[model samples]
Target: MIEISLTPIRRYWLASLVLLLLPVAGYAEDSVWKPVPLGDAASWPAWRGPLGDGVSQAKNLPTHWSSSENLAWKTSLNGWGDSTPAVVGDHIFLTLQNEANELRLLRLDANTGQIERNILVDTAETPREAPQRSSQKFHNLHNMASPSPVVSGDYVVVHFGNGLLATYTLEGEEVWRHNLQSEYGEYSIWWGHANSPVIFKGMVISVCMQDSLADLRQEPIESYVVAHDLKTGKVRWFTPRMPDGSAEELDAYTTPLLVQKDGQTQIVIMGGNALDAYDPYTGKQLWHLPNLVGGRTVTGPVLGDGNIFTTRGMRKPLLAVKLADFRGEVPAEAIEWTVEKTTPDTPSPVFANGMLFTVTDDGIANCYDAKTGQQHWRERLGGNFKASPVVADGKIYFLNLDGKCTVVAVKPKYEEIAVNEINDTTIASPAIANGKLFIRGKNALYCIGK
Candidate 1:
């Protein structure tokens, strides 16, 4: 034992040094792969394109694409989902669920449509046992991954209906995972939650809506806008809604919109019976617009021209309110206008060039004056539209569930510019990024561009 050599000790020290530096080297490589942001108006990084308004600033986006024509590339997805694709830099990210309710995240090379990585994020612990309702009834679109993904830089965030929220690196390594369903979320309404997560600053915001069950004596079921630290999956703050204790009115399936007005950043959330605003940084409620009738909300709110526009009720009215000041309760007079009949129950509205444009779930596109509530034009594009419309290059692209996209000129007068069809059914909305359009169908993802 006294003959231990110094050479062996030196060899061990060198091996330890290399092991210690390996992680640092990998981190440095990751930091260099920052995504190239779409600087122009045509690219969309998240749901409904840029600004979360479904309006594209891009001009000259390809209007016609088929299986062989105008298509940049088409890739067959491994799993099925109703979620849209998110493009950031050279990669596109989306979520899908297997027949067994096992959720997966996929990353593809945006230019080539080659799948870079497919990672299994979460698995449903138990099989769905409930009886399937008829087509007339609204319930969880079983096995359909309906939540869209949000991407910033190299980090991609996704929410699965099973209450799983996860983040991944550009290389497809899972960074963080959280089970909102098991922790604080419960299935309440007929349709499972369909709200897409929105990113603000460094946090990811999601709406967790669950109704209180009498049998469980659940704590007053509350809907909340929760901000989580992007890197750690830790809840930063939770802004709770005023509980109504009514099971039918306790759900919110709307994504929160982050907007900047009058030098203040606000998070706007719409739910069963109210539209509310909060400070994005601290989760403090700034204002609440109450008395909204109880009905499941699907579309989130949109902000434009210093006002916030929201739709409520499964078959109700659309409301537009001006947010000129933020210190107190907004006066009733602040409501600019309300529109009844033909308001969308699923897709959100789009604002472009001083006009408000929305497509009804039945395929009617309505345009209104942005400053006033005056109706400008209403036209039937002729297909049911569950996906939202995107405006790019002064043109509006409306993707319908029947797989037809009606492109129209975004003017006060209605003008159908072009009609393109892909033959595949789609429930997810389209995304525009890097001069290309991304559409998620029932079984595939398509990239269309010039």
Candidate 2:
């Protein structure tokens, strides 16, 4: 190499300095992938668990835990919320709302029940008059942070109903924020939005089903499912739920689930007055299952064994349809069957073994054959349940709103094993990870394990 002049040497030195600082400058841009350790056998990772199907692979989960026994640890939460705890590695994450309707995200160490970080997220806007007759009076039920946090590797995604979607690192550093309701559309409901966000293939998906009955003349009263880039807060795709409708009943609060069948990926959405499927990659409508009467839906659809199971919150029938039937404009025939009595109107159904287990909003737990909708046994577990049931290690866990947890055996015959109790009520679903159980009560987050 030939020696350069002083000026050129100075320029070379500056370039070298820039390169040395390039890694620091691009630290945010670098793909910082955090390996989420498998949770304890008694811990929960997300609203449901690792599979997002409400089933835990762990075998050593505690069968009983109460206010004074079998509890690994119980920590008082700062705010009120129905959002479930999401565990990733040794950390537990959740969202809550204080009395002022201020949203907050909290992370805790799974081992010691110590809070790692708690950050204030959003403050609810002033409440307008109730718009719908079916709306419940607003209470301190932590409605603002009802949607649970979903942890994907190092990043945790939280959705605050009124349209705030945010991503934070495991260390509680907020990466980016997006106000989808303000930017895309406002919520249509009087009860407040409660749809949770889901992640798949590097995309974070959310369903905006607003039912603004008072503002019937609103221009953009459309219901849609949107996907955003997980790393950057960029819109990837948006599929409108209703093409040309202004009906508030078409709005929903149900989250969509990703299903893969026959080498094709479909995002199954149950909302408003219809059941529909969409191409997850492009947000293209694939098929529709109409004739569904719209109402306030709380439970999302569950996919299993090539079939989709869904529930409409109102006095409607529970639906189960085969996924292959969506290949055409309309299915040739009705795929399976439906049950009206004792069916779940809130909690999502869980499929384990060859049986389908569901707990209704009024606390009725029923077991049915997954292949057919035939009921095996119906029993009242006593307390009301808004959270779904979780199956782990041959046992089914039911969390009721009264803070009672019933554990049953997942067999052909129903077997009530144990009824555990905590101090506070729990509307958020239970999560299982590594080998621990994470339960988010109205007043505390509990980690039950060895």
Candidate 3:
């Protein structure tokens, strides 16, 4: 969606749609095109795409699109969210919160961009923004639906800043719903909660990095990560994480990254003044690197070349942690490098074609060698950037907040492809599937293809 307007990470702990062995409910059988399974490489089932990275396996995705050119379908959305649309089979799902604060799960027909169903899962009487925050309202730029939905097999999990978590079938039948505030306590974040859920091994996982309630109440104001059963929405396991940082330094809006290397799987989570790897199956901490103690973190972390590059939150040093022999406390040698200047605060960096690309919130773009951190290129693209780039067809598409997309080649030297613009302002990242690119803006959803 590209609205000339307002706006809004997530876990890579996901299951392949093929692993979703349960059949989609019969309501979708009448479709002429077979729905793509939620776990297929070609489907955009979670934040950043199926592999949990920004790069898309899609070939021949549209390189050109505007308000009226190469437009396949355009559907108007009722509310605002900064979440990327999740595509599975022939349906697209996005969470929306209207002015009334009703969080809705909307399913649309992929081929025609026609509305299929809109299910109201939950509603919050107060604004999505926290009460402690002033001059901020959820309806203006973003709301509880900022966290993108995760589609795994037979279930689609949707979460919101207001603590609502619900599951629905592919056909939009309600399965189960719960609230984090009810399970835990009131939210203590300064702004709002936007951590999205990740699905893995039949469990949907989520985490929160919030402020301590030591000043507000007696009950422990703890931060933790937990997983729920996909079928029953029952708690599988919960692990409390107490970072040593104080106040706002503990706030984290980053979504978890599922990294697998050397035959082992770990959930890479950053927040509360540290970066830690946890076992997805048992909710156990595998390793941690602490003392980051920076401001609130927004940029989701990325992985490549045996390293994980992460923004230390709030324009702090962008640290590269090497994972060759990481165990317990991270060794000093594990930090390959730290790039302090011109790091992104909101947008996550992308690693592609032996290069690392980062765009600051103010729109400064930098490219570095993935292994040695050698500067490849640095240039300003103009405008504010919050949406992460989409990599495909040997090109990276960088989107600004004003809805301008600057396409650049992925090579040692930077080469501009084309700059395209739409009618709306946008903050949600783009998704690619079935040879088409799906973009969500302030008020509408646009599909671009040849």
Candidate 4:
């Protein structure tokens, strides 16, 4: 196991200088699209579990637990971040940054919740200000470690708000790293960047949907989707993503979602007033549904029952778009149903058992039929919510900011089962594996199991 302690000598100036000297371009790798293999059923390896949706196969998950009851282990993690754990096999990968501004990655033992490996990935400061824009500030609730670590192949890719994307082995050996802003341009987003990278076939995909600065100058800053070689960190392909929106409407903190359908896979992204898909192998735009026209988006899209469900930013209407063999532009008829009331703004929706569940940042929970879009029930779960809900066993877990998890049945009707409290601040979403629940709080990581 590796442990890296933060020292006074480590600084961001050295890291920035090293990244600025690396090459800016590289040749594309093979174009054959081989999907990322789902290694184990008991692992929650990515942002939204194994399927990139918040549904877990783990059974008999504990529905009720306090800070002392049904607790497997609680390990105190230094510093703070709002990233969900990437649990694979017996290791849990997480990212955080201390007051020293040192971005770090820790691999913990799953059974004992012990920190097995801790590596200082990079150093970056928070509230990275734009040139002359004071209104474009990062929120106080999150920092550079807000983007979660993604485990792909034998490497765990971690990203920081400073545009530092680095890959390290599971054993804490560095593979390669890149500072995106050094190669591209400085970010001009309203808030901080928090988009987690997604692993596709043989490559890692990342999205940057931010302020174009078109409102400020003649030529707008480019927002693009870029793919890099999983093993070498070389740029494989880059597709410019200039959507038809302006001002804050152009900003998106949402992550890229990989959707596999009928033996074909597409990278689905929701932001910049549009929902679109891209070819995984070639970095080409596949199809787009334009004119979504919502404010800066944070809520991501979810797939269920042969349809894509998403909400526009700022509590806009929820959309249920049907899948099609679309070419250039998706037509208006592709929309199956829509619900305008009680939609979520920050937390992404979760689907299970033909029912979809969503909780607004204000704590209102709404259940809908996954296919018909009919509202089955709407109830308040209480407390503010920033974490997305996760479903396991026969219940859906709605975690609030106050570290309270309200477990409800997966049926259409609202049936509350248990309300568990941990006496900590939890904003990151929960991860489930092997019949146990993993929750990352503000100061500690808690494992709840029977």
Candidate maximizing TM-score:
4
Better of 2 and 3 by TM-score: 3
Return model 1's CA RMSD, one decimal.
17.7
Ranked by lDDT, the better of candidates 1 and 3 is: 3
lDDT of 2 at 443: 83
Best by lDDT: 4
Q: Candidate 3 on 1-450: residue-level lDDT in tens?
A: 101110000122112212322343352333221111227878899988877778778888777887678899889999878888999889999998888878889999999999999988888754544455221234445667789999999889999888888889998998988898789876777767888888887888999888875556576477899999999999999999887877777888888888764335678899888988888889998778888766889888887766788877898877776553244665444566777678888899988887889999999888888776778888889999989988988989999999898999988798988889988889999998887889899899999887
For each candidate in the order shown, give its overall lDDT on alpha carbons: 0.72, 0.73, 0.80, 0.84
Q: Which tens-of-lDDT digit does each residue in 1-450 have in candidate 4?
A: 111111132356345334333222331232222223444667888888888888888988988898678999999989999888999988999999999999999999999999999899999788745554322457888898888888866889999888999999999999999998889888878788889998877688999998887878888888999999989999999999999988888889888877764456788899999999998999999888899887899998888766788887878878887655466776555677778777788999998888889999999998888777777888989999999999988899999999999999988788999998988999999999877999999999999988
lDDT: which is higher, 2 or 3? Answer: 3
Candidate 4 overall lDDT versus native = 0.84
Error of 1 at 449 (Å): 1.0
What ranges in model 2 sit over 4 Å off?
1-45, 125-129, 133-142, 212-215, 218-220, 243-248
Assess every candidate by TM-score. 0.85, 0.85, 0.88, 0.90
RMSD to native, candidate 2: 16.5
Candidate 4 versus the native: TM-score?
A: 0.90
